[model samples]
Target: MKMAARTKARHESLGLSLEDVVQMYRVMLQTRMIGERMMQLNRMGKAMFVGVADGHEAAEVGSAWCIRKGVDWCVPYYRDVGVALVLGQTAKDQFLGVFAKATDPNSGGRQIVNQFSDVKAKMLSGSVHIATQFPHAVGLALAAKIRKQDHIVVTYGGEGATSPGDFHEAMNFAAVHELPVVFVIENNQYAISTPVKLQMAVANVADRAAAYGMPGVIADGTDVLDVYEKTKQACDRARGGDGPTLVEVKCYRYRPHSSDDDDSRYRSKDELQAWLQKDPIDKAAAYLLQQAVAASRLEDMRQEIAADIEAAITAAENDPDPDPATLTRYVYGEDAE
Candidate 1:
């Protein structure tokens, strides 16, 4: 793809109907609230780790929903808060993971690994390492192929991971083997303090896919419908055995990269304010109202979501912590007892 292609292909809206946008509004808001609440958990002494996805909702939710859930796998990164929730990680499960409480979806309090999974849902674990899941997702796609399954794999990342060797190797090998894997990059313009322009020479991450002999396109990631439209095409391409695709989703991060790292240290106040002005949730909600969704209904929905989130927090707080000794149970490979 040409360097200017992603930018050129983008900026044109795909004309997603208001109904589709309405359907996804609740999930988007919930994910944003969840991300914000997780920060509260951190400050309140419940969570030890939190990777908020304040700005990456559209990319995650749209990508996850576009795929044939459970028929395809999603290897999400740490910041994939919306995608994880869309993949069925209930509020309680996520907060439970933060609380290290029993009954957490992934482990029932036994493991602190991926938050949730159901082969039927096709949602895999969201890893913490930048591009580590790239290879693992390829392995999963390889298994699906060897078994003659039709399932595809979706590997997501931020623009930062594009610089890693794992991203290159995974794309190269997936192309060579003709594996079913779609690489999605949520290019939020910045990798923490490092701006994306400084991270790579290419104008857009999607343009770099040509080196791997794959189609690379950019999506208006802030626009959920655009994200959905682009990702749906990529999913179709992978399912048809056309091989991998690179989708660069242009977005912005409204908050710090993580709890321990504050953007104020490196980013100026004006930049942060600029991004916040384009908040995805507000955009979706506004579109919903414009679509004629009842204002009362919207308010009720918000209240319901708040109630549910609060309940999840309470459950996470009330649930007992994992046994201190059991940390070693799921840590190592099964022993030859």
Candidate 2:
């Protein structure tokens, strides 16, 4: 098999090896498959809820790839399961949270699904509220700067989150202090049922970064390499003490906001189909194929991922639920009692 000239050239220009992009594609695929399985579990009553990253996998994985798992910090939102996975939180780990099993590290079955956390990976625990993690990431970045450490911080949220005051506060503080933070907005066109048109008056969420005295970038979230390149640039700038960057990755949500939302009420079938055509997993696979990856090889990879997910599901299901007696363990201090 011969690599496509264009694909090879693009990767070379970005200073990325073929293997790096291929691994990124694998993580993206893993995220997509896991999200799909979670949705299926929800429908089957095996799980309570799922906030999938189907159409936004590239943005999640690619941006996550830019951060050093154990060095830089990741402040992910509830929908950023892909970022968590890429940061070393396995499918089993996520399933434990989804199933509210005792082994779940994020909350021990206390928090909602997809609120990923891993101290070793430097991934901060996420919340269900929009834009709350923005200030948290900014705070971490400030700490790193004060300590004169090389650590940087990466945070993610949706387009709708940009409307929140938390977002502006974080952006303003990071810019003013020149904190080492990168803000990634996965703009999927809708905030639950509210379209981008109604969410904000700005044409591009990235444009708001200029007002905060930082660079604003718009990247194609459906293209993994494009996202990787843009994110790498942002990470580099942040590490250089050039201040934060607001990156708006244009993406779409292929499913309803969650297992509970009825997307049909807001989105048209035609619009959904159009976005499906641009699915990030499909786009990444096509690029790999163009790079001389065999179709059979891709199929084999898919099978391996499927088996991994199945194993995770089994493990999570077999794991015991949190001990009811310990319900207030993390909630209250012993002195309070």
Candidate 3:
């Protein structure tokens, strides 16, 4: 197998070794497979709901790869399965949340599916409200700065979240205080059924970053290496006391917004097909192939991932539901009783 001259040159320029790119492809693949399985479970009535990161894997995984998992913090939105995975959440962990099992670390079955949390991983539990995690990320960054910690915080949201006051407030505060945080907007071009054009007049979400006094970058969301390079620069700047950056990754979701939404009324089939041609997973696979990774190897990787997902589903199904007796355990203070 011969590596393409362009592929070799591109990765080398990014300072990533061949092994690093391969591992990144693995994470992206795993993220896609996990999301697909979750959606399948939703259709089977085994899971209540699912918000997939089908086309946003590169953005999530690439940005997450720049963070030091346990040291740095990730305040992810609900649709950040790839971020959670890269930050140390496993297939089993995601399945636990999807099934709302007692072992579900995020909320112990209290919260909705895809609301990821892991204290050990420094991933803040996400909420149902859009852009709410922005303030939380800012708070964490503030704490890190005050404590003289070297760690930075990376927070994620959709482009539509940029319309929220929370997003502005957090960005403003972070910039004013020179907090170490990176704001990543996975702009899939739609906020559920609402197109990006209806949400904002600006051409790109990153265009708003200048108002907050931070660098704004637009990365190709379908290209893992491009996303990694852009996010790495932002993370490096934040860690170096250069304040925050607003990165808008241009991507598209292949699926409907969620299990409940119908995208057909809002999006044309042609538009969907056009985006599908640039599928992040397929792009990464092609890159791998050009880099001498065998097709059989990719197929075997998929099989292994599928088997792991099956095991996770079985474990999650057999796990007990949260006990009714302990329903109020984490909800209320003991003094309140």
Candidate 4:
């Protein structure tokens, strides 16, 4: 009965026209494919680990789409591959980071993939410590304010990270200063073995925004339209000097937290089955097909993306690995020991 009930509520892609639907559909599909490819590499022993953004694509893409890459700053987390890629990362750079090859875009194979450093893109490097990105985001927004620039900073994290004090302090700081930042929590329901209910008291993460005196919104993370609308509204307000917004995106994770986790120990098969039925990429694809996107055009998009992924994998696999000789080259800047 639960399976039937959950399956029956498969997400309906929201948007007015077919073009907008197809654009979002492509992004969702690409994100899923990237996660899938990373998983394959992990299994092949080519990569040490993989962070799948399988279920959080909608929120990621929606957030990226609303901001200008060159002007805005992004404090991304480890699970932000899809969002970063969509915003401006190349396939080779992303794959190279996973492979730790010398050809990696950001680190040149030195730093981990998550420590994404790019100045022109204005992407603040990521940290392994959860919730750290929040404060960094606040700092960046404060800097932008001091510089009198129009750039806004957007940071992302999970509902589980919200349990930490950093999240609270960052939100409070952003609000107090009226910083141009958007705090987005991709509530994927499960943070490793713990579920959302165990992590917090409220049903929605955005509800806490009131304490900071800012607008808060809850969006359907499975539907790109919902995320896009909410993100644009927040960025617009922030740009207008209305302070920050807290967005709680309600989404599900089809896979475990990382490749190492086995969600079965904590979550029941029934729950997984329920969320699996509403896969955002598949639902969005179905919406595009329903909207009369030419079958040939859809096939072309698939072929193009597949070729792109395959090329990236192949290149990164053969690329030169990072040299051990210079392991301590950048340990303390150019002049430090």
lDDT of 2 by residue, 92-139 (tens): 998999999999989899999988787888988777888999999999
TM-score for each model: 0.89, 0.95, 0.95, 0.91
Q: Point out where model 4 deviates above 4 Å.
A: 1-21, 335-337
Error of 1 at 186 (Å): 1.0
Candidate 1: residue 272 lDDT (0-100): 68
Candidate 1, residues 63-84: lDDT per residue as tens digits? Answer: 7777665567888777776877
| Superposition error at 325 for model 3 (Å) | 0.7
Record all residue pairs in model 3 with backbone atoms less than 3 Å apart, i.e. clashing. Answer: none
lDDT of 1: 0.78
User: Can you give the lDDT of residue 13 in candidate 3?
Assistant: 91
Off by over 4 Å in 2: 1-8, 332-337
lDDT of 4 by residue, 60-84 (tens): 8877777787999988777777677
Q: Which residues of candidate 1, in runs, are more than 4 Å off?
A: 1-20, 107-120, 332-337
Q: Give the Cα error of residue 273 in candidate 2, in Å.
A: 0.9
Q: Tell me the lDDT of candidate 3.
A: 0.90
User: For model 3, what is the error of residue 279's alpha carbon versus the real structure, in angstroms, after optimal superposition?
Assistant: 1.0
Give the per-residue lDDT of model 3 (tens digit) for 36-80.
998999999988988888999999888888999789999999888
Poorest stretch of ten by lDDT in candidate 4: 6-15
